[model samples]
Target: MKINFALSAFLGIALFASCEKKDDPAAANRTELISEKQWILTAVTVDPALPLNGTLVTNWYAQMDECDKDDIAIFRKNGVYEFNEGASKCDPNAPQTAQTTWSFNSTETVVTVGSSSFTLVELTKDKIIDTRVHTINGINYTFTETWGIKPS
Candidate 1:
């Protein structure tokens, strides 16, 4: 009788331990949202508009040429980033696409493209918000860049 009880207990524990866990993506991991997507630079704004060339600049994206404003940025799973010119090129002599490398820090709070790093203020299925803070001459300015498929 004691042997039967021991065998039953061992089998129960073994069966519970052998249960497989579901392949659920973690909430904190945002890899799925950023990889394999064609994101467009929708807008860029600087708080406390910083002085640039004697002018207080707020909308940074407006400073870009129309050709550059229509470019597409694709972040791939293989760490390669492709900047493709949709239908216009700033320079007719320049290539239609450019390639660069991109990586995220271990914490995934910041993403580095080539040598430049930007803090990720927000990232979702629909959009990505990047920010950079600078203290120039004791003045704090926050530059925010929003990228998405549509107006953000």
Candidate 2:
């Protein structure tokens, strides 16, 4: 009889413990989503590929050197942004990491890192996309950059 009573109490307690509110990923805010993962630049595309030295430059990210390609970024909740030179460094003498302050605009639609700001197009757990329109050589171009969670 005592064994059955103890088992029932254990099961009841287990059930209660399982019922505790857990953080829902879908319900997480932008700050939470941004800081949750180490980001790696996946792609950088420019609309209306610019002609450069007889070749149209569309994917700027692909043009980056292997050393530059492996760099990563981490956004901290405390308004700190870290730019990490992953396993490789473009310049051996350069610091392995750089940090700067970051913040979102009043509406959270724009994210400012250092002196630059980008409009957030998409922000998800696995990926983030930001865009900006810049005038280069008197031509307005839309640049889109994408970042994905660093792969294991």
Candidate 3:
């Protein structure tokens, strides 16, 4: 009976160890998470420190139509980034595809796209948040954008 009890305890401990949770998805596969699906901008916050900044911030959403809201961004594993303007055109004369290049900084805290770079605020399986600050003519503007995978 003693041997049987000891064996059972050992088996239980082994089972528990094997059932440990896996590594975090974000930490293990950030690039895969960011590149696997097309991300659409869900929300944007803009803060500008200029006289006309208020109007720009207030009228930001109104400036984009329904189709503009559906614009999707694709991040390729090869470091190519493409922005597809949705079916409806914001400007009929403008090109639909905006191709660019992207790369993560050494620490992976910043994502650089072409000449601009954004601080990666948050990255998860279903959501991403990036923030950017720009200074123009002594005026500072900060923009924060949240993106999510496109619905099936």
Candidate 4:
């Protein structure tokens, strides 16, 4: 009788342990969706076909940050975003300054902004990397950039 009881107890403990809930590892590190987060540009990698190096690249890239200490862009958790150059404040007239909503894909690695979407190839403490395949000026290209999150 004692042997049977011990076996039953062991089985019960094992069954209960097997059914215990476990946390998802990926979900724990996920960044919560929020509003008003500022994303600053760090580096940009353009398609080989695009002019992103040499004199053309330097000239256009300089124009991008002409007004500010650096080229910075802010994507608000509330759906507003600003890409400011050296300008003291974001100018609504600037081509890159616009308000838009964002959504994450099931994996939470890809973000959809307005009607366009980009894959989050990687994200780190100081940089958020993304890639978008698009056609600009009738040429298809993949645009990738690394951006830093601004301090609050």
Considering every candidate listed, which one attains the maximal TM-score?
A: 2
- Give me the displacement of residue 134 in model 1, in angstroms: 6.1
Find the 10 residues in a row with the least total lDDT in model 1: 9-18
Q: In candidate 2, which residue ranges exceed 4 Å CA deviation?
A: 1-26
Put down candidate 1 lDDT per residue, 26-139, tens digits, no spaces.
Answer: 443465677777777777677898687789888866766677667777777887877677677767886777777777776676777766667777777767887766577898
The residue-by-residue lDDT of candidate 3 on 1-152, one tens digit each, is: 01121111111100001111236443545666677577776765557622343344433333434766777777788988777766776577757777777777766667776666677777776788776665656766665667788898
* TM-scores, one per candidate: 0.72, 0.79, 0.71, 0.55
lDDT measured at residue 117 in model 4 versus the true structure, 0 to 100: 62
Can you write out model 2's per-residue Cα lDDT over 48-118, one digit (the tens) per residue?
Answer: 88665688887766665677667778788898877777898767886887777778877667777777677
lDDT of 4 by residue, 54-149 (tens): 332322223343233244554555544444443443344545443445556665666665555667766544456666554656766655655666
lDDT of 1: 0.61
Stretches off by above 4 angstroms in model 3 are 1-26, 48-63
lDDT of each: 0.61, 0.64, 0.57, 0.43
Choose 1 or 4, whichever is better by lDDT: 1
Quality of model 4 by C-alpha lDDT: 0.43
RMSD of each: 20.7, 19.0, 19.5, 20.9
- In model 2, the clashing pairs are none
